[model samples]
Target: MVSLICTLQDHRDDVNWCVFSAKLLATCSADKTVRVYYTKDFSELPFSPLSGHGYPVHCCSFSPCGQYLASCSTDATTVVWQMDSGEIEAVLEHPGRSPVRVCAFSPDSVHLVSGASDGTLALWDFTSRSILRTGGVADTTMVACSFSPCGQLFVSGSMYGDLRVWNLELKQLYAEKSAHDLGVTCCQFAPQMQKGTGGNVVQFRMASCGQDSLLKVWNISYTPHAGCKMQLLHTLTGQTAPVLSCSFSADGQMLVSGSVDKTVTVYEASQGTLLYTLSQHERYVTACAFSPMAPLIATGSMDKSVNVWRVEDGCSTHEGKFLPGEEAASSCEGGKMGGHSRLMPSDWSEDDVSSWLRQEGLEALVDVFKANNIDGSELLALNKDALATDMKVESMGLRSKIIRKIEELKMESMCTGVPDEYLCPITRELMKDPVIAAGECWWSTSGFHDCAYEEGT
Candidate 1:
């Protein structure tokens, strides 16, 4: 993981989902292609691009047995493909819907379950290529759904603040809980559960996040006569904004959460204790996962970057760290106290820049080249070479105009590199929220213990 063993850049846009099967890693992109990459980098083309989706691909998963592949698209269908041939073995279509948002293969590989934006859950018979049952929850876009590790149950959390625990075998609702006050963005079942110190037979636990700006954990216990008793055991507050994604570590000791607040927090499972916050992302952290084989945590963000961090290494802080010759470091002598000037942009102010806007002047020429969408780097080189000739007011005016034009161009370029669907819903320079950094140990927001009840009433 340290070396970035390989790079797969086939997708013309964002790669939203990536799933692994023993030796194969498959990625689904907004470019409407599912690419399969071998773990052992092939000297030849390492990725086989599987394309056919009529719309952007949203999610992809490999079967538990690692023999089959599944993907969901904005095209209103879920596809199951044969890994070796890039052939579609089954297509599960949902009518009266915008698109399927999530799809997963059960542990036994007998069933494929998909949840869509229309608030419908479709159970598919994987072997027969037929829809088993289609059920409706409140009509809200479903963001994420997962099959319980045991394959005995399935859970769907909606953007409408409803979390449904469904008995897959029984094909009925076991428990419906309002876990979030607003849309439930992400939810995950605990990897393991056991009877507690008080003899409370906890079968499983789940964590959910949403618009309420809090993470809620439920204690799920099965009773002989009452079906399942779901209790809200703990409400953890740290994220300052809605949590967009959450995942439980394989060992069940740690839980990881990514939020629109632009940070990732890892928590202790049993006691609902906050463990660490990983917040290196400069933009909204979209998805997070704990490695099934190691203590590594991976996070994807709107910063157009993916980061991997150590589980033991807590949240990344942007606070200043000592480094040599960095200008902003403490070691710098006499650079001016309270140095705000250093932070100003090079072209902070301009006056009489009209002369620089002409077609014949170097700055004017660059402006013309830019407006014509000519070679940008070539124009940049011409401007740099011309800058060495004079320090006249006319030259300065031209420079200012060129600078302004460049700024305008950059602003327009934002979010243009990726398809509109792949752009994260929350992305405006995401940073670690103050609350998430404090974890469960303290309410850093209010500067006290048990702060939510004190101030939030």
Candidate 2:
């Protein structure tokens, strides 16, 4: 079901948390540094390690678009860094000067939240980089927090074994007094919305791991009349020791968790059945995150090593990796591309994109793309970030394939060496059906493939 692809041993101390963007991997450590890696081969970035935190870093998260990373530390602040240049974007000080234990960016990347050791939570307007409001639980350390897919609600877990849900206005919507018996270590909302049982109601699923040695799945629903309601769906007991962290696959079909027993467990999220139990970490497993667009996962531990795993669906010969750019482009040329793109990919309409997706054997995704109104230009703009985040593609392999085909289309549109004879005379586009007229010298340019000549002589 899974195989270890590589191991990263860059952090000098205990690895606290691990997170992934479309293109990069970030891991924070008790050594007071955060290391970034390229997921293609698990290679370190040029800047390698980020050392802005004055004290040990406890958690790390990447912004929605993979352009920035946020890391919180015992130094009493959460620092946001530009992903490309490895420079600090802003240093956000937690309220009450307490050690920041956790941080997360909303689905839209418009807001950020940081939880402190004193139970204080600060919500920031990410664009303006200013605190918007403050709220928290009483007498407990804020250790876990995650935003809902709708970007309007978020849930925070405390050391007091409570899970509290809050809106952007800092108003408490729901609170489960003892969601976890001992304490909560981590929680994350599944990235999709489900229709509630009634009209105008919305439902969501969230996964949380705790010191109680249990991995719990929850269903939370909200409506104007009833506010928010939470119910436990399943409690998995596959891990022997305390479960420290948990994450959901982009499509929400699977869940993964790391535990103090030095093992990583993968679960079939829908049925709560254990899929695999990985024990590659030497010390306590502390962190785990699934790549946004690939069937790959990274897990970090107290052993000071990050293990990169390739999840298998039992089909790919590429061995859990994507095809090289050149090979992918050749596949696109060999009729793997969508329908009627015809070298003018940027001129595609919503209907055209649908037709293309259907032709590419992605009929299941046609509605998903149509709901988003993906046009020619929008389809061309589909990167790993948008495919996984905005479109919610489930299979890591599908995300990689779609992106590869899109890149090939982009390359075709940039080609400037087309011969004049192989181009349509009137449209100046590539001629797919070139033909000679009755005179043999007259080229048929009338709307391509058809000859139209009108004259009064």
RMSD of each: 25.0, 14.7
The digit string of per-residue lDDT tens for model 1 on 1-457 reads 1212233445576556665443455667677977775533422223367876889888887775455688999999898887657788778787575698888776556678888898888888776778888885756887777776545567888877887777654345554546787778777777554443332123678887888888888876642224566778788887888887777766566777777788888787678888666567676766676544344555656564545555433221111121122221211112211222122222212221222232112343534444444343333223433543532225565566555444432222121222323222222111112222222333233212231123342
Which regions of candidate 1 are displaced past 4 Å? 1-15, 37-45, 169-177, 193-202, 310-457
Q: What is the TM-score of each candidate against the true structure?
A: 0.61, 0.73
Cα lDDT listed for each candidate: 0.59, 0.81
Prediction-by-prediction clash tally: 3, 0
* TM-score (C-alpha, index-matched) for candidate 1: 0.61
Q: Which digits, one per residue and each the tens of the lDDT, describe model 2 over residues 119-203?
A: 9999998878899999998688999999987677899999999999998888999999888889999999987666554744667
After superposition, the stretches of candidate 2 with alpha carbons farther than 4 Å from their true spots are 314-457
For model 1, what is the C-alpha lDDT against the true structure? 0.59
